[model samples]
Target chain A: MVLRRFLPALPPLLAFAGILAIWELLSLYFGLDGLPPPSVALRQVPVILTDPQSLFDIVDSLRRMAIGIVLALVFAIPVGLWMGRSRFAAAFFNPLLSVIYPVPKAALMPIIMLWLGVGDASKILVIFLGVTLPLIYHSYQGSRAVEEKLLWSAAAMGMQPPARLARIVLPAALPEILVGCRTALVLGLITMVTSEMIARQTGIGNLVFQSLEMGIYDTVYAMIVIIGALGFILDVLFERLRGWLVGWAEPAQSIIVGST
Target chain B: MIRFRQKQRSFTFERGFRLERGLALAFAIAASTAGLTAASAQTIPTIRVGWTVPAEDAKYWMMKRPQEFPNLGKKYNVEWVQFQGTAQMVQAMAAGALDCSTQGVLSLAQGAASAGLQTYIVAQHVGEKAPESFSVYWAVKDDSPIKSVKDFKGKTIGLNVLGTGIWGPLAIALKKNGIDPDKDVKLVEAAFPTQEDAIRTGRLDVGVLNQPFAARAEAKGGLRKVFAISEEIPDIVHILEACSKTFVDKNPELAALYVQDLTAGMGKALANRDETLKIVTEIFKAPVAVFDPFYFKTRASSDAPLGSADFARDPGAAANYDGIQKMFKLYYDVGMLPKQLDVKDFKHAKIFAPLKP
Candidate 1:
């Protein structure tokens, strides 16, 4: 059973090794100063992790990302649920959301910075804007698929409208909602990096650009590796949590490897 | 019940569509009339200026010492917008967000040629009239085989930005040394701060270093200066103060007043070295020691006054059209500029007229 359990991990580990091999080969073939080999880049990962300043930047970025995702969850889930249940609410908000959906949240940093200044507020707001959309989208989809019978039964059992929504629709829609949360989690990280890159204040994004500017190729690649690892680890951890929370639900018909 | 629900849904969607269309139309009309409204408002017009680095742009210093420019608040207000690069500033200008900003010749050319951003060069910002003033240094590791510019023929040289202020001079230097800049050597974009480390590690043959970075590299040891930008392009105008043509045409008096205030501010900054240094350090959030040695000081070779003359002088005079034309030609020759640009066409005669001695 232990051997079988560990077998599932082998393919991904092999894929990781294959990717590194390809990267190393490409760097060697190009022989460009800017494109350092995987080994060289990997060596700098520990240096970045050990360095207090870089560590602080990474942690600060995660902290902002966490706050933004939480704010998005608190605000988006309800609105999404409302929109899904009420045709009027959906009609009212659908056009507005559609207009906002295509706008690159990171591109709003300059205007947002003008209004909110360059501190944590602007960065967090950008992350919030980024993470909010997917959560709302996913929650809407999830709640829309919730059984009308379940909501009716809750109401028949003396549950009020709000209670019916909270108890019956929320649980029934949770699997899809969790999927949205996972997507938002990825978007939060992207928005955090992009906003920081534009602002150039401080963060992992700033550190990455700073390294590039200084011609520290290894450090730049190392940052990419670290951020990639963070995304992967977060997705895995969230996947485990999702399994724990919605284990009784039927398996999704199609597993989406990448989230929108 | 289903028929009623369908009717209600259609009604809501129709209302939503109408609302969206109405709001969009209102926004378009408001946007179209915004310029006219501002023109008639008769309030103090705010000149939105974009800046990237605090140390490089004089506008940052001028804004810091507002008391020096008497016309700052009374005649006009300066809204300083921070940008990460000149390309972004160009985009902002194109979007009508910025009225004036410091731009390198390469950016100015690219903006005019490709981006269709018409702007008037009001005054010179920074120049390399050297042996006296600070010049960008291209350095290499002390033990590296690249002894001179000629030795860079086959080696990769790192630049802060690919085709901006420094690239023009480096291209000129390489051409002068009979090295075809395009084919003979490799140029990669690297930040000034990292160039020293890159060179030391043999990752780069030559790394471009600008002020503070050069000084810091020197203090750190292990790197030797291969060439100074001034050697190739003496008296080169590195950066120019450009005001949007639309802004200039609309408010000629304001544009001229802004230039006058700018020149006066530079004069004051030059006169008060101690205070200027303090302000610079405060803006950069660095130690005064990093800047004191070369902030505005002429090289030890010349006996010029300890003032702005070394960095920027005689704002009243027309721009150094000769030097600017040289830069344009160099950029054109380098294939950096899409086409050759004449300096006379871009100069704002009226704005600089008051400042002319």
Candidate 2:
């Protein structure tokens, strides 16, 4: 039993080692002259980790991600739920979503920057646009999947329409909703870095860009390692949170299974 | 009567036949549009001028801002693209996207000699600096311990980027002052606009900048020049207008006109300082009061004043090929250029030899 459990973890570790070995080989022989070897890049990590500003970069990045995700959820969830339930809402928002969702929102950064003047507000807005569409679409699909029987059963118990939606539709639809959140979680983190790099003067993305501009390639790779570690941790945290939230919905596993 | 009826039917049939022919012709035209576009490309010459624009290295005189080149508009169409650095220009040239780009010799050699891109230097200039004027300065905060390049050992120095105009001469200067560029000091790269703040806040011990920025920082009152690059590499040709070989071979006349117009424009600007300042003010969208009283503002690296004979009215000082060749040899000796990049290789004798009139 111990061997089986430990054996699964070894593959991922071996994959990481393989990647490092290839990167080192390339940097030495095949890669562009300016690129630092994996060993050289990794050596700078302790230095960056000990720096107070580097710590601030992590906290700042997380804060931006939180603000952006919250804004997305607040706007997307209600509109999405309403559209799923009410035909009037769908008619109002669906056309707009179809028009805007296909456009690359990052291309609009300059016009947005003109108005917001390259600050936190502009970065957060772009991040909101980046993740919100998928959130709304998934939420709409999840709410729409709530069965007529569940709604009828709630009504039979003399429950009001709002209460029925709250108790039956939302909970039953959460499996798909959490899946949407999972995608948005990844997207929101990506947007957080990109928006900072495009406009703002701070954050890990800015640090990476500034370092590369200065020919500090080792520092660039070090920041990447930090960002990758943060992304992995955040994704795991989100996975655990989903399991905890919908554990009762699935007796055998976690998350609300979308059977409706 | 039967024959008349036959004539009316024939007329109707003829009209139908004509409509069918028209539709077939439209379809054929639509089908061969890709081929027609290829043919159309050769009939007209489009001058695509690329420049990594900075305050010191602005090419606003190109006259191709909205649509057409100012002087050669009747002969050639113009398209423009702006880049942030020579590295980007080199990348675009390698991709066969850029036709002509203005850059320094250091970057030109890097592309031509190191990367083996077929490009030739067509025009040259000493940007924002006269022969007697000090251009690129290394600056420090008010009370920093770094008095000169010798003091730069173990201290952080700010640069724009590596393997470009500023980095090449800076390496020479540091070596001349008994400092190894690789180990003696730390180098940080920051944008020119942000350097003043970085220097004032002590984020960088010394920041490399060119006028009017170097002059502007001194005017701001807490910064002082640590050393001037002109002290080491004086009269080095600052900007070289280079073109890809394909563009030169395909459109030799347009290429010559491009260089000639650019040369004439620079000569006119150098002679008429007031008109140039007016143009600069208009381009930057600032009032007259923002700039120095003279176009050639000079600053000293030490406590002494800049050695200037007020300012001579030398218009052709910037068109010195000897100066460019000297900077070329300096870069090659310092290993900024590839070992094989001869001075002759930079001089494409056949095409667009600049008239220094």
Candidate 3:
């Protein structure tokens, strides 16, 4: 029945509506001493949008993230694939990554500031470091999972060595490699915001941080909303691109891409 | 024919779609509920307070110094955090991780006004007529032509946090000197401690300085003192002892005790300047002279109650409301406060309730 189809969509919509209502109630009642209400926070959307500087901050964040992600991908994929495909390579590097991966990138910010002098390089490098481990780990797994049959067949067909790799191994691992890239991109963004918040003097993190310090919780919330919306839009766009590139693969293959 | 087939044919597609939508809906509802519940649970009974004063300087308040701070045990459960700079310390305060802290009057007023936190004046300390109060100094190479605040018009100037400390004061000074703070000068905001290196490489024309670093800079290249906020605008440099109203409301007696102990400590420190200088120097890891000139005369008044009663009786006392109110206005006129908040609304006086004074 038409009712059955409609009922399925009703819960999420109702739940979100309930959430907004509660948020409004909290803004009205449990206000943090002198902070503005949710209405004011909502109104700031247009104000932030109209302000050119807000846009600049967003663009700056994106620019930094792009540079960091690109660097991470360039370094992670080949290195990860080499390490994953070769046991000797994995043994040599795995211990190093294992030792360093769990250490918070944020804790190293001051040292980075000292060595790199608190410029964009330090920020970008921090972002790059944050993403590189996950990127390498994911790519290594993806490379390891490349079907052995396909490589054997390519070899049996007597294809040229480079051609065999290009025609067989790369394509077989393409979906998983893209998955690594997606994780790296997300990690890069997290680091971008964290790095900016912890030190540096610019970007969305700085904007939110400055607002918080000044007791402009509305602006802080507004910046957070912007960051969330930006992340959502990015995830959607990446999903669409993944679908276009690899929809023929199983839905399971696309799950990681969608989550990112 | 179509009706019969529709009834007979399995509703597989519809069922799949319904299941997917149902899962998404459930997830959304669950997530919101979980997030709200978790957030509510995280709200603890006690308030957290942070200080930029090193652990050693604050050791008197720690449990280790049981005699000095009887207030530190499980009765109050005060959480003390430490930071390296006023910028970060105040930042933590804004995040609600700190209920009270000591910072430069300029930064404190700006932060309190903007954040809507009630900033009560607990104490005020004054430094001498020096170019720096509590900041590190920036000095150019010996050959640099920048001689004073006037020469800084077309040159790069290193500053600490722009709104909080030296930035606003420096801006006010520059505007008074017929130089636009923004258009005429390139203001580079580096952390207070690192400006020395930035200056060493000829990156800045006039480097902002606080005592010991200024003294250090003078030793390095014999730099000139262009301007001091305390000098340009006297009494603009008061150390504010402030906390949020939520904190005061929850822990009135505890808050009063905090004020009492801190004021007592300030009194002791002031009376014994040379020894206090040694202690503060060790705490800050800066030279003794860095703290020497800025150290104000602390009045040993155990009877001076907390809040307005203490200030009302001694209007010109070490931490009077009228003087702090004036400094707060200075911060407002310079566009540091987000909007004009009546300074009176900020005063929450209960300092006399606990103390017999």
Candidate 4:
């Protein structure tokens, strides 16, 4: 059984291994005159890690990610729930959202700097704004997807509004809500880097932009690898956390001994 | 009776067809004649000049606002757009998106030379003591033990980039003070706007800042300058207004017009410094008063006719070029450049070439 399960994943693993090999070969073949090879970029990893500033960068990025995710959730879920439940609220907000949702967040950097100065507050707020729209849209959709029958049954039973929301609607909407949270989590991470790119003094985005400007291609790739790894870790951790909290919904299976 | 009706129908069809053909022929001839007249009509030529300095900041040259490349518009058609950095403006010049631009002398020199763009210094914004006017300063936290350029050894010094403007000036200044800027100090790269914040947050031990940013840092009280490029490298040329050789070659008259307009702008800039400050205020959208320290309203007249003497005449040029040669040599030494990029490789036939009136 172990062999069967493990063997089935080998193809994907082999494919990834092939890609890494190709990357290494290409960098070495091309030489470091233009773009540094993977090995050279990797060599800088130890140096990048040993420095306290690099660690501080990681911590700062995570801190921003946390703030952004928290803000997204706080605003998205409540507004999403209300709009999902109330037709009037949806009508009022939909038109405004349709107009604003497509505006790029990078364009807001100059204005944000003018208002907030070049500080952490502006970076965080821009990330929050970028992540919130997608989260709210997704969660709002999820909440609306809740079965009308379930809501109708709860209402017919004379259940209090709070009890109905907590028991019937929220649980039914949990899976979709989690999906929206996942999207927001990823968007928060991306915008955190993007905001730093535009009007920031520190953080991985600023570091990468600085390195590229100075033509230090090695540092750029190294920073990119680190950021990608951080994103992956965040995604995995969120997945595990969501699993633990909402694991009760995991379908249980039963087997009948028809042979016996 | 049927035959008579058929004949009448044929006559009606023939008359109608002839009438339609005549109308179509008349319309086609009239449209072609009208188009021929329109094709020969002359349209006024419009020139767009890109400068990193905001129009308000550049108000002395202003006809009105930052975007309006005045005098040129009044005399000839010209629009000036301002950017926050020389890098962007140079990029525009490289892409043929700009007709002319004003960039830091160092940046414009390197860019023009490399891109094979014929560039000439049209005007100068002169300042007192090159080193004092344009030096990179080392600043440490008020309570920190870092006291001098020598103390910066083994510590990271924040600069915009390596092997560029600040790198060269800082290297010479540091070496003069008895330290190898390259080997002793770690140059940390940061954007111009972020230098103050980096210094304030204690992320950077010292930073090399220019006028507006430097002034902003001084106001915050956390940063105190330990040394400046101006004090060490006095009378340094920071920026020059330039245009491409191709542009000048293609439109010499227009190029001359540009130089005249720039000279006019510089004159206007110095004549009405207070009014210019108001212009800078509107362009940057920052407080109008931010203009007071970054720009020396009166000191700009130090260089006569705006485009005065050759850089060869300036002592700061000795240090500046020596520093650039050293930087180029470092790049060659470290295999950063494929071959030694002599100063000649980066210059054109018209480098500091006079803009004829």
Q: Quick one: best DockQ, which candidate?
A: 1
Error of 2 at A183 (Å): 12
Q: Using lDDT as the measure, which candidate wins?
A: 1
- In model 1, residue pairs whose N, Cα or C atoms come closer than 3 Å (at least 3 residues apart or on different chains), thus clashing, are A213-B191, A214-B194, B132-B299, B316-B355, B316-B356
Off by over 4 Å in 1: A1-129, A137-149, A154-193, A199-260, B1-43, B54-57, B302-318, B353-357
Measured against the true two-chain complex, the DockQ scores of the candidates, in the order shown, are 0.07, 0.01, 0.02, 0.01
Per-residue alpha-carbon lDDT of candidate 3 for residues B56-105, written as tens digits (9 for 90 to 100): 23333232343545554534555554344555545655655567766666
Residue-by-residue lDDT tens digits, candidate 1, B1-357: 112111111111123333345336535644553333243444787888876653443465566778767788788888775556777677667767678877777788889989888999887767777667767778888888888888998898999877667787778778889999889998888767667668877789888877666766666677887887777878877667788999999999888888887676666666777988887654543457767766766666654322222354543323677888888888788788888888888887667622621
> Which tens-of-lDDT digit does each residue in B1-357 have in candidate 2?
112111111112123333345336535644453233242344467786766433322245554232324555566655655444666567567666668876776777777777787876776544434445655678888798888778888998888675556676678878888999999989888776557667876788988765445545555567777776666766666666788888888877777777766666656666555766676654432345445443554433334433221122224323446666777777788877766455566556655434431
lDDT of 4 at A70: 66
Q: Write the per-residue lDDT of candidate 2 for residues A50-167, one digit (tens) a residue.
A: 8776677666776666767777876887778778888998999999999999877666665565566445677778888988998899889988987787778779989998776556
Residue-wise C-alpha lDDT for candidate 4, range B1-357, written one tens digit per residue? 112111111112123333345336535654553343242333556565655433223323453543546445555565554444675566656666566766665566556546655555444443335422334466777887888777877887888765555455567667777887657877888765566667766778887665555555566566677766555545555555666667767876776666655555555555665876776543332455454655542224443211111122221111234444455565454334445556554343433322334
- Candidate 3 lDDT over residue span A1-260, tens digit each: 99998998899789767866887887677434224565677667777777676677777777677767766766876777777678998999999999989988967766675566444677788888998998788768877887777667768878875664444544555567668767776777788888875554347775665454333457777777677778778887877755544444534321223232
TM-score of each: 0.64, 0.52, 0.48, 0.46
Arrange candidates by TM-score, descending.
1, 2, 3, 4
RMSD of each: 12.2, 22.3, 23.3, 24.5
Over 4 Å off, model 4: A1-260, B1-42, B54-60, B63-71, B126-134, B175-183, B297-357
Model 3 chain A weakest lDDT span, ten residues long: A251-260
Tell me the tens digit of each residue's lDDT in model 1 across A146-174. 77777777678898988766666666677
Candidate 1 at residue A58, lDDT? 90
Question: TM-score of predicted model 3?
Answer: 0.48
